[model samples]
Target: MLNWSAKRPVIAAVAAILALSACGSGDDSGATGKKDSDGVITVKLGVVGPKTGPASLYYKYMDQNFETFSDDFEEKYKVRFEIIGEDDQASPEETARAVSRLINEEAVHAILGPPLSGNALQVADVIQKSQIPWLLAGPNADEAINYDIQPNWAFQTNFTNQQIMEILGTRLFADNNKVGIVYSADGFGQSNLDHLKSWAKENGKKLTAEESLQPGSSDANAIIKRFKSAGVDSVFMGITQGADTATVTRAIEQAGYEPKTIMTTGTILTNYKTIAEPSQWENIQIVDPRNFLEGGDKEILDAVQEATGEAPAIPTNNISTYAMLDIYAQAVAEVGDANDREAVRKAMEDIETVHIGSLTIEKPFTTTDHKLYDDDPANWLTYGFDEKFNLKLLGTAEECLEKGC
Candidate 1:
């Protein structure tokens, strides 16, 4: 592995050699000058996310691994890639502007992320007009598909809110009939609440209590009190912020209520230990895409650590980013032209199954569906803490989907 931080001289030398190699005896007439007489094609790929905002850590992991991953991919597929990264600062308007720059200015063949749901929605029009293949690493809401705003060229690597809530509801409802819900007032929280409602109705169960708290609010005592009053046996949390989930957990404990509690994804696994008391976390179940500490591909984990000098707290986010690039590389190699965006889009649509390291994606991309792992329960995992406060994988979403509680 090339440690760019410690071995700058080696990286500089490699870059010099690659630059000389790219200057082949060919007429440089195009904007990107990507075509060479030797038939070696170079394509630019853009990545957009919150690299400097509150969620910068997630993008930092992806940025660190991109160079090494692209290098290896080029060596294996014989197609050169020039990766470009942009920071949206977690703003939707900035995301749209960044997309324009990537497509019209940088001439990137494909793009990854814009992490947040609202940011992805803001750029849907730009992506559709450019026909550039866009892979979203976050924004697990279904509004992208439900509103028909997501273009045919875009694909979501994360599980949608509907998929996650359905699985969680099914599992919780199996043993408890009096289920209460506490959600944020934002789009993501509301979306999960709506899905849970549908799942409850389908399972012939009624929501004992429901509470909606505004984003960034710290007062959760009322919500907890309401659930307690309703004699709820189980409490489902739809809060997106980690601190908020922690706040609610604290309230639940303060109220001296010990009902089975479940939390949604995006609750930073690393921060949970500090956010809530050990006893509070012990009774909490987390619905997540993958376990960060014990559930990722070893090889990919090593690569990320080597690049970032730290292990990712949420391995699935980084893994999904890596998977998206791998899929793009596969399409470029199969299409035989990195610059032909149309051919690459079609190639991705035709892909049935792909294995990147230890992670497997079966028919993840298709013509009608842009959501990867939407109905595939294997892609989602449930996690809980042991008696000793150590995290453990409970089961896959497939169990809940196949046999609802």
Candidate 2:
């Protein structure tokens, strides 16, 4: 491991830390008429996310799987991929723009993601209006479905906020205690916070204190102080990037508030070490649902390392992006034609299994079953960090799933 401490100058902030968080694709020129011969094939797809931001670096990790999926699908199925286009600089406005470009201009039938939940809300609205069935691999905004703005055409791999609470709250019970919450004032953060709160309350836990930080305040000390004042025993934190884990950890220290644990839905475990001294890491916990690939999962891992020429830190959201691309490719192949938009959607919806890396979509998406992992929390795994930033397996979600707050 590179010694960041010795090499660490007294810089104001980590260059990586300054990178934005919370949140991309290509064009096939022959896409218009490149239909499969025996049957219609060749799929056009739109991938949207913030590529240029604090979290822009994540594009690198996600893009690798996208490329690999594209190539492998094309080779194995003899199906051509009109896969095209990427929008990384995030904005629901930009996401809508990307969707318009994909549906109207690029003519893609299905869309992979607009990574952030809030961004997904915007893009999902546009696609649903177009009557395009989109299977989402990112964003867990419960309101998207509940608000009535989202159509049956829009779906995700997991449950609503109530399900998250049903699963995590049971394991994360706080007897007679109200839950603590913190998030960015941004729409995405608030969306996640809202769901967690609703679920927390249904389980008898009140939202004790709610606080927000100004956008771009990577250091969470100030916010932690406010949550401390609120006397929260546990935290429902919402942040864009996994790197923010360190900042939240530091903020908790600043506030002198260390609860029994911290839970972040949709948050990755890659950056848990950044928030404080290494020894304090055990105090932090993550409800991540996958086995991390530090140096494991030789095929994809080695390929990713080779693609980068070295091992770049894998973003917390990296697996979803990888899995999304793979799932898309599998759907196209299973349908035997990438040309049919609804067919592609149907195939994607029918993703009942996957054979990749350490993770598996044991019970993947289906027309009837949109939920990815089984409602069984055992399918989800918890994770943490070792002395370095390597991912360490904590336990299975089954071990912690519960009903009350």
C-alpha local distance difference test of each model: 0.66, 0.57
- Candidate 1 on 181-251: residue-level lDDT in tens? 88877666777788889888887887888899875677799888888888887788887666678788889
Model 1 steric clash total:
1
- The whole-model C-alpha lDDT of candidate 2 against the native structure comes to 0.57
How many clashing residue pairs appear in each of the predictions shown?
1, 23
lDDT top scorer: 1
Best by TM-score: 1
In candidate 1, the residue pairs with backbone N, CA or C atoms under 3 Å apart (3 or more residues apart, or in different chains) clash, namely 174-405
Write down the worst ten-residue block by lDDT for model 2: 11-20
lDDT measured at residue 190 in model 2 versus the true structure, 0 to 100: 82
